[model samples]
Target chain A: MQIIFQIIFSLFAIAALGLVWRRRADGLLSKHSALWWSIIWLAVLALAWYPNSTQVLADILGIGRGVDLVTYCALAFLFFTIFRLTIKIESLQRDITKVVRRDALEKNNI
Target chain B: MIMILVPAHNEAKTIENVVKQLLFVGDKVVVIDDGSTDDTALLAGNAGATVLRHTLNRGQGAALETGHTYARQSNADFVVHFDADGQFDFRDIPRALASMKEKNVDIILGSRFLGKEQKIPWLKRAVILPFARNIDRLFGSVSLSDAHNGFRVMNQRALNFIQLTQDRMAHATEIPQLIRRYNLRYAELPISVSYHEFGQGPIGGFRIVRDLLVGKFM
Candidate 1:
């Protein structure tokens, strides 16, 4: 339990440090997809706590109570991915509006 | 009036020199200090350039968008994107402006590869150049080289048409697609590149490959 706590604590602590030093750490998230980045960090967190959370996650996954850790992680990742896609869709809407408006204005001038 | 836009992040060490060089060209300079923790904005302001700040570090595309918005609001004729890393040449600014006058091209791209003695990194030359050309070919684009070259001169019409939203290093890739989509007249002029300075090394080719694949599918 203590080791699990330490692992989770340390992993987040490192990511926190990374967030703090992100400006200096160019190309860390710049290279990878934000989805994969989120998945990676979350997976690390799950791996750290799996020994404790497995039984609960297993019940949730429809398997033995010990295998739900991966399931829960995947479900959580899927949710986060949907959220990311929603943001992208919103941004694309704004961009599309801008394009439409500007194209109209340009056409009027000619 | 000319408005020079220098999109910067954590470029305190080189911002002042770039600002001074831009001022030497007798053009009004605007430095987009994209949430640099360092004194990039302060030093740029002290060096006599108007500095704008983004509270959070957005990508280069965002910085360029900020500059474009500001320049358009201020009724700027030509908005030139010069690098804050001191890799660009100011002498070519007049030539770009003149090219706009002569050829009626809306966007002027500075090409490091087109010059007689180009100094682009080998990885960029070998991998990225071909990738860019291929991407252009796939889009049925002709008459543009090194679309991802950060250094560029964009006019008011081009700015309105080319909405840069990639907001990161991908903005370089975004410009060509926008140009093609909007049917904007874009031309490339040779510019010198010297990537041999301190802290310059080739990034992983696989990392670039990953970005390419992700951008393509996404």
Candidate 2:
């Protein structure tokens, strides 16, 4: 189980690095993206490599277990991603509405 | 010119009649057919209304915003946001306009709770309405007798400030909050609205609450 976890964390770090490179190549990566992907994933890799470190951090945070702390952190990240996606979708909807409105107005112009 | 905006979704049956009635009262009547699969746009256009269509069904609030945008661009003096369900009396429109003029107010909102002629169903009046009223009170400082009533008229000043963002039924709640936010002078006049089969019942109330809760984040 520990070996499997280590492999998964290594793969996630590689994937995050790949994404940052792709985004940078496309000129779509902001400073925030660069920092978030690099810093967070590197930190995650560190935690995965030294599993005992999570327990030390968890103890400081008053969490019962290292796994529980990791779970909470994962959940928080998932929620933040969901929130960002929702806002993006809403903005796209507004843009579509603008285009539709413009077309409708031109069609019915009198 | 007075621009009457009717945001319709699959309202092919009543759009013509609503547009015609509104045309009689206002200078120009425009229908924002919110992606109706039926002949809503065609019928409304044929009935002499400037029809706008959404490619996808966004919602009533979005349709209303589209109509308002067009109205503003056309330099409309006053904009009346009417329903395509044919529930409101067109006769009251002139009265609403007159009241706005008399009071020198920016917005004239129709209130079924304020008038005797309106026969709102018992469940809606007793349960859904009071709940909505309380929610509106909690959301904003603006106090209105009927917060969900769709019949409303806004002058240029009111339209310029209040930009609706909710794409669904939550716009009703947002409107009152806007009045409080902008500190716009508004009056609630008693008006009659008929309960239709699709627009009434417990399901409708549930839907309203659900959409409003969802609208909080958006």
Candidate 3:
């Protein structure tokens, strides 16, 4: 029963990430960012499945069967934050490149 | 009103002087300090410009985005990009902006080749300029002698029109690409670059190439 629950939870997590990526996805970020993030998500899933890792995490947090739930939530938040920051930085870099090119056009093509 | 956005990192030695010069022309100057461990943000802010900080040193491109977002949100009628490295003369800004207005162009770029006395490094003329123009002529129709310059003014239309999907040095290469892509009116004026007494290498060769390639994947 526990194994089935873990599998279902893993599938749901992936589905949610897919939804976010599909809805707001921009050209190649959808590909690059997803690839990195999925690796992180896979690690989290591994931690969730490891019985000793789960018990130790639960003990550290002083929780019960709640370790699984807490781990999943924490992993999701961590992955999401890093993913968002990467995209933000990508857009920021794009802005500078645009400005320099615009300057070039003004002097020559104008 | 015009807003000046200077995106800098670890430029403490030069940013203050640059801010002081920019102050002469624009209504406001904003600096995006991209994870500068040095006193770049403090110096720029102390020089009477508003400063925005990034917690990590993402890159120069990241810094520019911060400045642009701030300028657009402030509703600037026109915005110009400034370098924190203190290379260009901002007094020329009035000329660029006026030309932008007169031509009804979305943006006006500066070219060092226009001025007979423009002081620039010989290597740039020999190497980077030729390479840049060739790239422009072959893979793109930008038709400009230079594409990596940082001195420019974007009218609110072009300011809003710019879609900088590129997040790296490719943005420098892509400016003309995007301009043509967006069908925005553009003008380039004669401008010069001052190589520091201690010259830096061709500004961003590897990173620009890498980023441009990475952008293709993105």
> DockQ: which is higher, 1 or 3?
3
Interface RMSD of each: 10.0, 2.5, 11.8
DockQ values, each candidate: 0.04, 0.39, 0.06
Candidate 3: list runs displaced more than 4 Å: A1-110, B137-141, B197-203
lDDT of each: 0.71, 0.85, 0.72
Of 2 and 3, the candidate ahead on TM-score is: 2
Question: Per-residue lDDT tens digits of candidate 2, residues B1-218?
Answer: 99999999888889889888888899999889899999998999999988888878988888998888888889999999898988888998999999999999999999987778666677777887788788778767389888678999999999998788777777888888888899999999998788774364567656666656555666
**Candidate of highest DockQ:** 2
Q: After TM-score superposition, what is the CA distance of residue B194 in candidate 1 from its true location, in Å?
A: 1.8
User: How would you order the candidates by lDDT, starting with the best?
Assistant: 2, 3, 1
Tens digit of per-residue lDDT, candidate 3, span B106-206 = 88888877666666667867787777667555435467756577788898787776755555455666777777868888889876567665332466665
**Decreasing TM-score order of the candidates:** 2, 3, 1
Instruction: Report the number of the highest-TM-score candidate.
Output: 2
Please report the candidate that would top lDDT against the real structure. 2
Please give the fraction of native interface contacts (Cα pairs under 8 Å between A and B) kept by each candidate: 0.00, 0.50, 0.10
